[model samples]
Target: MNTLPKPAMRPARPEFSSGPCAKRPGWNPENLSNAVLGRSHRSKIGKARLKEAIDRTREVLGVPDDYLVGIVPGSDTGAVEMALWSMLGPRPVQLLAFESFGKDWVTDVTKQLKLDAEVLDAPYGKLPDLTKVRKDADLVFTWNGTTSGVRVPNADFIAADREGVTICDATSAAFAQDLDWAKLDVVTFSWQKALGGEAAHGVLVLSPRAVARLESYTPAWPMPKLFRMTKGGKVTLDLFEGATINTPSMLAVEDAVDALKWAASIGGFTEMKRRADANLAVLEAWVAKTPWVAFLAEDAATRSNTSVCLKVVDPRIAGLSADAQADFAKKLASVLEKEGVALDVGGYRDAPPGLRIWCGATVETSDLDALTPWLDWAFASTLDALQAA
Candidate 1:
């Protein structure tokens, strides 16, 4: 056999990115192609599967008996927009911002709907000042910022009985971390993120307060068919059962059900938390002694286990500039992905220049650990290339 050289190392799977994250090992897309395809979403079999997905979601999330789960279109974005549009006009809003998605909601609330609110904002790497939340204001916050890779430590900051409701975009935090249902009014997420489910739908969970808002107050404008949570001026419990707001991809529902079932078989939230903890340990170890690397979050307790962001620390490397750092990370991700070692490591475009790695529950810690050294190699390669050029 003729050999030129041996490869340094081969990764077991792609490195994790936050959303549209690395798929579960041995996930065959064709497995879904063979799923209950071409069935009417309202058919008996289809309804059973949809209901099962919702039930499993409720079970795994430990959702309170007073809450309801609805399957809706447009993934997490839709779930969140529906909540914002329906629930905002009646209350003074406290919109919190720490990262890009939060900023997006701010734009929607301020510039788009032109709503009145108190904004509790912070820079990317820090937590929002929760102490300033108006007790009389409805609050909007993301439990985790997948962009900046920072998260609120807990919901303990909220009052036990604030008059205004809390609407949370917990897309990245749901299932991977513990969520206190008592403190939440409307919580929304997409299956595509941590659950490794397909796109096209969102899971919207609402507390009794949110439902009561529906029963009491109507939006000042005509509600779209997709945004209308009520039917004939009454809350439609069937939407929480099996009737989705719009037509859903049966295949996606099956895929989501499979992911939920997998979560259940491995022991619901405990297994998810275990996987997330293991991944975070790997990330923490990697960030500790890498010479030029440090966590973006200043505080360890508030650092996100799901979306971990790292910044280059060596003063010598600071000369490269933040934009350069961002470009370098994108190059690193591209190179690794081309070699099949990793995929999607660059920070979100709207975030500060840094590398963001996902440590969500569905990702294998062994795969994450195996990819860390490759990051060093990637950085060194970048430095050498820049010097040579």
Candidate 2:
């Protein structure tokens, strides 16, 4: 039996998954025991820390004064759903989709919210045609699709002055990429992505426009207890200021605090951006030398720095059945996994056949370099396996 050679490259630590990514801040996990976790979140101390996390996050991310932060329930999904269910009635709704999370939003808009939505979509490897979207429509979009490794490079296409609101699901994009605040009316993210915090909480940042819409426009459906954000038919300022309707884990708040504190210590957003860019550079160099490899997303500018998707280009395997392609990718992923070269390199369940290596902010560039040669060997051995079959 032939085997891939062991790679000499080694990260300062092991890495490669998208979320629950390798811990960068390097806070002592043992410190969790000393943290105040089991206490009720409504207590003064709990709310204070949670408030600190929200405020510090704003400072680190440089959110504008007009945008208010809400510690909402659910991870990124919950925050996004709340925005969709609460804010999409007065204007025409446009759903921009390119990947799994974007597809989820499409389902929510058309199926769950049951709104009359015009879908501006591209396949897994492409970007939605933003040029054709009705600029005045209330738009819901995923800034970065973690599954497909595609992200919108710029927000210039979004009209500066429009009647509609732009609600963005920025879960993976929050700390990993720079956001154009002027183009977005609402942005939501979870602590679990680039921050490496607990998963139960989501951070919802609402621009003045979103708040205005909430006050002036109401959805045609019942406001469930979880989704309710209004009181007296007005957008409550309290919700944006440490008055979360639901209880949150205080420890999670501390973890978020630690993550944000970590971000600040590492020279803020610029440093995080640098790390991500450098890591992607490592992947790009690796992808260049491999003849059977190419980006799933065609354009370099549109391709995500956080999650990089790669496709196998061997002509013999290219025309194989879908199952065969999947099997081959899985075999390669498994090979890397066993060798400790990578873990969780498989494509998301909804995406096409390929390896999706996450190169988020928290992930160090050295790890990406370490994982590449291992990939080269894994695919080579897998091809040999396929030929034997």
Candidate 3:
């Protein structure tokens, strides 16, 4: 039987869920005191606050001056859907899918929209072949696969000069990775991922090319009022200037601004990337020494620093049936949660049986460092219980 002792030191803050991740360090409810509550979003004060969110986003991410940044409803999912429904019918489409969210986009293109899109896919822990991509076809892909813990290493595969536009879902990669903005036409993300802001709101960034597509092409199907971005063959400039299509929760807007301010105060995206990288390094070190666990990402270059997934490599666990392995992983996660060292660390439902830990910028490296020992204890204790059973 395994005889590992329980860990004495626990993480000071353990809000490690991948989505709606931990808030910025030293965050307080008082930070949102400036929110303009009980006012229409179209009012002066409300519009100014919304505009601040867009401006701060561009400043921190180094977005191009020509690109238009806007706040859209429905988190990252909403932003992507709007883009697909608005601009995809103009040309041939190609999609790269390696994870659950990526697969969802493929479904939207094929099943929902009924577009004849060419799909390139890979199993979990790997990326689709970028060489197979065609420059003539409009491309849709995720910069980082949050569920599978994989990400495209860079934007080198995208053609520098191509007829097609590229749409990127960068929800998890926005604040934590370097994005090659010049190569991308449309990019979408959420405030809740790396910045740890409030959820249900998405940020959509469109290049001049993307705006041109919006102004030129109209989908054959009916466009929902919420998805409309153009009027009389012209892109809606008001949306980019913070005139939202629907009423927004001012409290959530306030929380987003607070998070952006925190990001800027700490030297902006560079510092955020450094913190996330350091947090990932902690897990890398642990996995290198731990005999049982391995990263779900097959290649080091493709591994994600934010949603770091891990699989059990020990023969005892790997030898079990698929359902049994999933149950074991659940038991391991429960042990950590019961001990209060980690919460919501289980792998995504559609992903392989394993563990997924959030290592976003808002998560402290010290907390990750503290949590590794607890992970070891949980694994050992779970294994012991299984052997006894």
Best by TM-score: 3
Per-residue CA lDDT of model 3 for 1-389, tens digit only, reads 88588878899998899998999999999999989998899999999999999999999999999999999999999999999999998789999999999999999999999999999999999999999988899999999999999999999999998789999999999999999999999999998899899999999999999999998888999999989999999999999998997888899999999999999999999999999999999999999999999999979999999999999989999999999999999999999899898999999999999999999999999999999999988999999999999
Give the per-residue lDDT digits (tens) of candidate 1, residues 8-107: 6656777577778766656777656645678888888888888999999998888988799989999999999999988888889989899999988998
Per-candidate TM-score against the hidden true structure: 0.95, 0.96, 0.99
TM-score of 3: 0.99
- Top lDDT model: 3
Q: Is candidate 1 or candidate 3 better by lDDT?
A: 3
**For each candidate, C-alpha RMSD in Å?**
3.1, 1.6, 0.7
Tens-digit per-residue lDDT, 1-389, candidate 2: 55667667755565677776666646677645545577767677777777788899998899998899999999999999899999998889999889989888899889977888999989988888889767789889999888888889989879988889999999888887989998999999999888877888888999999888888877788888888888888877777777787888777777788888889999888888888889889988888887888899888988888888888887877889999998888898898888777888888878998888878778877677777777878888888888888
